[model samples]
Target: MLPPDFTLLQVVPELETGGAEQTTIDVARAVIDAGGKALVATRGGRMTARLEADGGRLAQMPVQSKNPLVMLGNAARLVDLIRNEGVSLVHARSRAPAFSALWAAQTTKTPFVATYHGVYKAGSGLKRWYNAVMTRGDLVIANSDYTRDHVLAEHHLDPDKVVAIPRGIDLDRFNPSWITPDRLSELRDSWGIAPDDPRTRFLLAGRLTRLKGHMTIIEAAARLKAQARNDFQILFVGDDQGRTGYGEELAKAVSDAGLADRISIVGHCDDMPAAYLLADIAILPTTVPESFGRAAVEPQAMGRPVIASNHGGTTETVAEGVTGWLVPPENAEAWAKAMERAIDIGAAKRTEMGLTGMNRTRQLYRVDAMCAATLAAYERVLDARRLTGKRP
Candidate 1:
């Protein structure tokens, strides 16, 4: 809960597809429902309509640009927005926009907040400095406990300033009972999966990128095929995001393995609930640590078991051998063995695991819970600011 007159401004790169974008929209809706005005500053995209539909205002700008000059210009623009809109606080969800948001918040004496959405890499000093802007917030929100720890260790910030609030999954959208037979059939038909085909279905849904470990999944599929385990269909459901070369490489790998029919690389699907409904198991074999794996929880919410890389946020979300198996990251053999176990475990056991996962996901990762915690965090920072005799 927040003040009825509170006006919160969230700055992000764009209203595009991803966990962060969805969270931004979710938080905006929460703010509006709580009797507060919500404004989002971004380079608008497809999700803008959804945000506006929720009664969230949009402040379009080139906040996605990484150019230093552009960031300074954005700060000036944000300063004007904050002052004119009577914004009570500024929250940033991405690094590039954060620098500008930080500058604007400081210049306007507005309480600032940020969400550590990813475990970013800093190979050099300059990069690390750039990443530190997220830590400059009055209060920093980490999407998972693992992420909170990583932020403290990486930035050496005061521990009290950082808090872990795991990303919430929309259970209503992912619920099995909410998905109709026709929705599943539509996705299956679009993906060219036959109605009567009896192969176990596996799905790996996310953007197609190198670190997402598309190669590792391909290798494991090949390993399964080598052992004459051909009664499985592994669907890679994600957009390449303009990585044409990697897409070609994955196609070639699938062709060379003689498993083209077994592995399908279908681009992004809007109906993820139907996509997960069509799968017996969901996979997330990211080579790197995920700050918090939203993908891992979505499948479980659909009453389906998951098999994700055993590291990062998944370690917290998935109960190994209970909800799903957590194989070693990037190890094709381990993944192959895990897949084999999942197949051999029988339908009853898999369904039992899925039910366990579904219960856990519902208890821990609801959208309303996340929003309540986030708004409470905002209240805390604003209270502190008021106590310090600062302008609100």
Candidate 2:
């Protein structure tokens, strides 16, 4: 049991719809359920209301600013908040906020934790130094084994201080049993998928950006179409994030390949569980390494087969021929062949694979497990602080 007065303050850029923000809300719910106060300091977004509903308080702050002067002011403000709120621990999820939270935690003599949520690329000394703040946590959390290895290779830290904890999904939300047929029909209809159509729906979900391999998937779709394998429909679901040029390029590519009818680029989806249920196979053809690909895990939780690039967090989350298939990154031909294989697997084998993935997800990637591990880390830091009699 947690101490009644124990409080944890998590800092992030915004309460938005992403893996980090979702984890922030999950941990906040865990802290509350454990009889402790949970506080989040972030610029508000769509998830702010949900966070509050889950018993987490929002302390609005511009911790997202990267300006040196603004960051210094943020550090001072965070220190004041820590002291006034009697915060027992400070946790940060992004680099900009981590700097301020790190300074405040040190100044207030409070335990600090940081979650490495991205595979931060640093091609220069200054960038490397900026990225080093994540490794400065009293206890550093890596979202995957690949991420932990990246941290160990890039940062000079005691290996024992770094822990790899994969991001978890809320099984209650992603469960296939809870999603009704109406929900599936609603998503399919929104995507213009005909009720009697027998074509397999291949879904690639993420921001409509180059790094997500939208071009690569488009190329793969072209390859499949050229092979006269037109029994599949490829769907790209995500916001363009105001990248009109890129969206236009994608549409032109589809037109050039004569696959405009076979491929559709749909915008942001509100119900992911239903979306997953509507997909025959989910794809994550990323060009760069992901820290922890929630797209890979969420679909699996919904009992859908996945086909992700053979790299990064997907390497750990996806099993070959069991949960899903992994193809070479950025290779259209390879992706096309994999898609063919998925189609050949037929409905029975696909159901078997989905069942395997569902079981694996339940055993390893549930949100409750992540919360337990995170709280355990916090307890370690708090225990040390108690023994040393540290105070602001």
**Of the candidates shown, which would achieve the greatest TM-score relative to the real structure?**
1
Top candidate on lDDT is 1
RMSD vs true structure, all candidates: 1.5, 1.9
Which regions in candidate 1 have their CA more than 4 angstroms from the true location? 390-392
TM-score of 2: 0.96
lDDT of 1: 0.92
Q: What is the lDDT of residue 224 in candidate 1?
A: 93
Model 2 lowest lDDT segment of ten? 383-392
Off-target runs (Cα >4 Å) in candidate 2 are 389-392
lDDT of 2 by residue, 32-73 (tens): 999999999998888899999998899998999999998999
What's each prediction's TM-score? 0.97, 0.96
Q: Evaluate all candidate structures by whole-model CA lDDT and list the values in order.
A: 0.92, 0.91
